[model samples]
Target: MFFFGTFRHSLDDKSRCTLPNCFRDDLGKVVYATKGLDNCLNIYPEETFKVLCEKNAKLNELDSAQRRYQRMFFQTSFKYEVDKSGRITLSKNHLQIAGINKDIVIVGNNDHIEIWDKDIFEKIDALQNEEFESNAQLIAQTYKE
Candidate 1:
């Protein structure tokens, strides 16, 4: 499923946050949350996470770099079920890693969702806007047939 949008949300005192309604159906009941690039947390559907794990498993386990990558990727991951109220409780570790407190921004990154601290997300968003025109032009030029 392709996720596309930027939504603002707040974590309750218990660290529970509601999933955006647009993503709720595609996310199903459970999702895997893990460390993401850019210091955000990634939320992936169960099947998608399994596919990712399978791909990672194909890498040579004998290689030290690969092993370390695998360890970091899997060890920090957690599976969460979206409650009846469409909420998920983020782990304390995950929150701290992403520097998330009460305010958050959930962004759709094509195949997965990214959870970012609101302030951090704003900075990233500003940078994206600054580069958007050039990026779009590059994409258009590269894809032109």
Candidate 2:
């Protein structure tokens, strides 16, 4: 499953955005949204989201610290079914969590798509580059010669 699309749009006051038709056409009729790191949203096809939830749910919950992390991610998950108009109503709280009051980007991420606040996305990307630069050798080492 390969996801490919880029959407730039404004979030309406009701916490809705027009998702790119290209992204929805092939991802099935039902979709979902979930919390993502660095203040962004993770969109998943229904089946994909189910698989993810199952996997996450099965992990041992013995450690309180880790459970907290799990709850943070899992509790924020939301299931959404995109409409024919290619629009989705993101939850108000979800929008706030992602700091996406307006202007946003929906980017393909292979198995999923990410919804991000434009400025925040750029900042995170720049920081990612810096970290990736420092770990280039270590990352390269992980690959077989």
TM-score against native, each model? 0.93, 0.85
lDDT of each: 0.93, 0.82
lDDT score for candidate 1 against the true structure? 0.93
The segments of candidate 1 whose C-alpha lies over 4 angstroms from its true place after superposition are none
Best-fitting candidate, measured by TM-score?
1
Tens-digit lDDT string for candidate 1 (24-128): 999999999999988899999999999999988787889999998888888889999999999999999999889998999999998899999999999988999
lDDT string for model 2 (17-102, tens) is: 78887777756767888888778998898888889888878766898876777787688888777777878898887888888868
- Please give the TM-score that candidate 2 achieves against the real structure: 0.85
**For every model in order, what is the number of clashing pairs?**
0, 0
Candidate 2 C-alpha error for residue 42, in Å: 0.6
